[model samples]
Target: MAPSDPVVDPISSRLDYDVGELRRAELAADPVAQLRRWLDDAGRAEVPEPNAMAVATVDADGRPRVRNVLLRNLDEAGLVFYSNRLSAKGQAIDANPVASALFSWLGLQRQARVDADVEVIDGDLADTYWANRPQGSQIASAASPQGEVVADRAELEALVERYERDAEGLDIPRPEHWVGYRLVPHTFEFWQGRRARLHDRFRYRLTGGSWEIDRLAP
Candidate 1:
């Protein structure tokens, strides 16, 4: 093919979402509650890794980074996920102390957004969760120096093997750098896709000590 050869456009592959309407009457007074309901729906629909979400953070340099992480815990307080304290996400959270998380359940034609303040949960909580993780995962988390460059896959595997040997006949402890952080949400948005590109969107904002809900143009 020539350098100037035209590339095929994949515009023909598109979807028309016709999910059910998101009515105000069906929404929970609390955004967290409403989000929980949607999460349940996602699980019931058999969406793979329903708890997975995309988290976005800004670094000290004012640049943004986004990555997918599993939602380890959720409640009225906020959403929680675990990571290495020295990882890029951790460093960004350290610098900005705020983040936005997005949960997309495309099969259900729905998405939920969370904008919140970040806070490190207590070490005890982190330890408990760590203890519950599979032995392999615990060893891998301990072995990985996340966001740091390695020579190659071979080096990473070697490190994992070393950790595996060390963890033999012992409970692998959570590394000091591995911990959980909670996002205490100040605002939330739930979007439901509809036919013809028009969608239903709602925003919930924390005002004073209560939450206020409003419909957003989509």
Candidate 2:
């Protein structure tokens, strides 16, 4: 019998809508402030996992990888998250030192995209965040070998048991391989959905250590 030809899927059609009817009064001056407002609103709405975002990183060879990670922290300096330094995402960031973050708050019909340069945070900062984690999470961090393939689930379970027994009545030290990183934003774009698809797009770019905001075509 002849082998069947490989099947390919076609891209979906793009949706069209008027993007000019959205309100821009709040986004006229500073995009960062507007982002903060939206984030606070998202929290007030009790959106499930409001801090969850898709983080994209590139490898040394320019291959891109994306995954969902909890937004551990955020500020004007940048956004922060923790991971095992030896993990795939960590290694990719180490090699490329560039990343992008996307936040989609569908309930609010808002999205935010951030393109940034990444750097591993200092040991002291990582330690401070580690100290704030729940005891169980700290224990799990010590036990699990993130991004490393194991024999099976049983193997991981065994490791967890051993670590738990050893950590009984004691503090689990943060592993050297586990730490936090920050992405310093070079550019940010804010999108707001509107009636009749007339959305609002505002972009802020860093130029000469200052931010310049501009309206973007939706």
Candidate 3:
């Protein structure tokens, strides 16, 4: 085979997406409500981790960074996800308090994008979610430093064991670093895959305290 010939070429293997459509009449006046509807549908369709969203942030150097995080709460306020305040993504959020998140339900051939301002929330809300977590997860969250380098797996296990021993006689309190962030969206785009790459897209943008919906070309 020639050097230019690839061993596994994916350029010609694109799948035609025709799973759904987005119509103006069917859209919710509020984008958040529309998002909730789509989320509920994804759950009913048994899409694994239906609440997972890829959150994108910009580092201090202006490079874009993206990582998947589970959506814990969603309402008119915003979308919430919890993480360590000192993690890489967290630092990025601190440096640049705006973020964009994408939710992809490939099985349904649908995707949603959210661009928003980030705000941290702690106090009772964080505590409530922390309390609902499994004991092992609590220990892990309190033990291992997220996005930090460790000597090895043994070092991490040791930290977990230490936390376990410390919490034997009492509750494992939530760490100060572990907190939730809410993304107050300024714009949202909902995409539905259609035949022949002519996907349907609708964008809801906040303008003058009201949402202005527009159709986007795929």
* Pairs that clash in candidate 3: none
In model 1, which runs have C-alpha deviations exceeding 4 angstroms?
2-10
Note the Cα lDDT for every prediction shown. 0.94, 0.84, 0.94
Model 3 Cα lDDT, one tens digit per residue, 77-122: 9999999999999999999999999999999999999999999975
Q: Candidate 1 lDDT, tens digit per residue, 1-218?
A: 54874466587666888868899999999998898999999999999999999999999999999999999999988999999999999999999999999999998999999999999999999999999999889988999889899999999999999988877899887889999999999999999999888999999999999999999989
Residue 26 displacement in candidate 1 (angstroms): 0.7
Q: What does candidate 2 score in Cα RMSD to the true structure? A: 4.2
Candidate 2: where are CA atoms >4 Å away? 1-22
For candidate 1, the per-residue lDDT at 75 reads 92
RMSD of each: 1.9, 4.2, 2.0
lDDT for each residue of candidate 2 in 13-42, tens digit (9 for 90 to 100): 444543333365656465567667778878
Candidate 3: what lDDT? 0.94
